[model samples]
Target: MSEQSVRRPTQKSRLARYLIPIGSMAAALSLIAIIYLGYDLAKGRISPCEAVFQESSIGLKTKISFLKTEGELEIGREQLAELTERAQMTALNLKTCCTVLDAGRVDPEQFLQCKGSARSYEARLDDIAALVRTAVKEGMSTGSVATTAATAAPTPPAHVEEQIAQEVEAAKAVSRDFNKQVVQVRKEQALETLQATPPQNVTIGAQEREPNSDLLTTNGLSLDTWVTAAIGDGKDSDYFVFTTPKTYRDRIRVELQNRSTTLEPRLRLYDASKASLGDRYNTTTGADLSYDFVAAPDTTYIVRASNYYGESAGVYLLRVTPTKAYDAYEPNDDILTAKPIELGSDLAAGIMDGHDQDHYRVETGDAEAQLLVTLTNSSTSLRPQIRLFDASKASLGEQHNTTGGGDSSYLFKAAPNTAYYIQVRDYYGDAAGTYTLTVNEAQPGG
Candidate 1:
């Protein structure tokens, strides 16, 4: 196996002369050359192209490694699930964002600038969406592999971890930028498409059907907080939550400030399954809708909003007061936080990145170290128990997580930007502590 010398013909010297998008090929050609050079150096032979291809192939096959983890978390089916879910989320979300801008609400200016931080705004959500799609495709493949390992023969693949590590590393680096680029492109021009006339109604031997329900629906919920017809309408107070878990009787109220205005807005919510619950509000101006939960909780439902759609002119609040307990966190769980934690003044907007909300970025490296956090004690007496749950959905057989009198220590892994939940168990004859947790990855995982 020798690395072939890379022989990329220059774009300007292409045999076929056709205009093209330069940035589109920039990262790819560069990646190919870098990969080729590395391959040749590694094999000490001259077929770099083959080496690069081999590396790519190996990366694909690495997901869902059948080997046992020496200890700690994982490189298993869960990772794939997470990746796929991310992909779907990104895809759907990106389409929604693009649709909004096309509809004439969001400004295109965010993407025109070039700073990474600048790109961090709504402009880069497309990149995250793309990344999610890639992750999902790979995740499905990973699931298949895991299933095969679970039932088929016991032959093991070599260095699956290393292969996967390389892929994950590469994936993280580009996903955000990809999403950002999409936004940037949008910013440079108006969605000229929005100006196009709506489709002609060719009645197909059918009575006019109910105006197709706006594609957005809150089946997962029945009631939600309506801040106003438009968000940020000079008045900032608007919010709500799921009144009853699994009970989809939405109790929250929304008062649209500009229902008379032709604004189509989107409302997003999350059920216990971590599924997205959304509704598109096409305006005649605006009307209020209440969302109720449809299922019981092994989890908590979360809510947030976006205005790529027209109704974005006003504030819509989705507010919920927990009549039910904040059971998502148990009394004894140790929680990790987001480093460069997104600073939000209040829970109304927990945190948002250029790509999404409720999620923040962090860096990780090769070894697990103590995690960074700030904790607050809530109960007068429940001491917290920190437990380690692995990707297999299996609790590590031997490692008992740290137990705390009130608060506690150390992050548990080295998977760069790897996410893990801290299990806080109700403990030692004490009331639970409501702690504020923050995590900073001293190094990003590879």
Candidate 2:
């Protein structure tokens, strides 16, 4: 070999050596970039997990509030069952959310915290469902078997509602706190994940016969049984038909009850001739609306219900039954035909209408006795008022407006052979119930 050939081989070897090192360096840099890119992509997965966790958290809150309200109202068995189904569905979704959140692996400790919190929320919901079922069972066992009350359950106490509300608030707080932690962990991983999506307003799902979606007609419902329904949004109304089978000689009594803190129920009655019965009942918050009147035989009666404010919605339980004929003598609303009660005698009467009043006449027979008049509610929630009047219907003294589970009493000196009238009316003109009136002569300081 010559000197030129050897020089060429040496140059080729140098070039090959330099290119090999350069190519290896380039490959190493590419691998590092790819690894960094893939890590960023893995962190990006937290965004969707955050979204799901947040959504499920809010949904759980709404369901808890709804359950509390249902329990407070002592809703019927069917409504309770519907609420149970909703809770179970929400629990299932929460479990899915837990799995997704865990897969994100943002922070192992926080992921575990969130999972445990989600499980706690689901367990609380299950407890609420169980409570509703127990309540329904107890109500069924103790309810009146008679067709009059129509197996309608009694209203639960105020404390029961308060307890339910407290429990729901606690569970809601847990869910809220867990969601906050999730967001915090997500932020630690990627600050952009902190931008939580706007939450949607939650509303209860509409039932089959939603008042706004479908009209409840006589064709769907009958009398003498309890029916449960909801008053949904936007001018919702419920209609029920009651037909007196000619054999019904007494009046038909209809009742509407609910525990909606938001809805004020209003009810009206109509006859087969499309004539208004002029029977109307409107109640305030936490009150029931009822109508009792003599319906004609072989006549079709229409009962319509709606929220008085036209803006609220809730579930309501209704029932219709035949009631005994009212014995209140007509035209005796005033002092004209006032029923006379002897001294030391007791009389039972009721205010059957919204604007109704009862009057009684008493004469102190030639004896300067100590007169004690008392009015008591006959196991009812009606707040009553008592007024004393002279024979000329002039007010003798201030009106008596004592209320609550106690009786209204007026004690005064009785003159000899003087006739006075006692007037009984509902305080606020919104209460109606049976009450007992007693006139007694208390011994002088004995």
| Cα shift from native, residue 181, model 1 (Å) | 81
Show where candidate 1 strays beyond 4 Å.
1-374, 396-405, 411-413, 428-431, 441-446
Clashing residue pairs in candidate 2 are: none
Which stretches of candidate 2 lie above 4 Å from their native place? 1-251, 254-322, 325-331, 399-401
Question: What local distance difference test score does each model get?
Answer: 0.38, 0.65
Q: What digit string (tens of lDDT, one per residue) describes model 1 on residues 1-446?
A: 32332334554457344434465587789998998688668855734334333443343233212112210122355644544443343343344344544422454443122222322322233333334344445545656667576874232233444455455444444445555665655554434443543422221111112222222222122333322323453222222233354422112332233443433344456554546666444433344433333333234454444344423454333443323323322212123221223312111111011111121233444556554433344434434444444433344322212354355434454354444443334433233334444555434451
TM-score of each: 0.20, 0.33
Model 1 C-alpha RMSD vs. true structure (Å) is 30.0
When summed lDDT is taken over every stretch of 10 residues in candidate 2, the lowest stretch is: 199-208
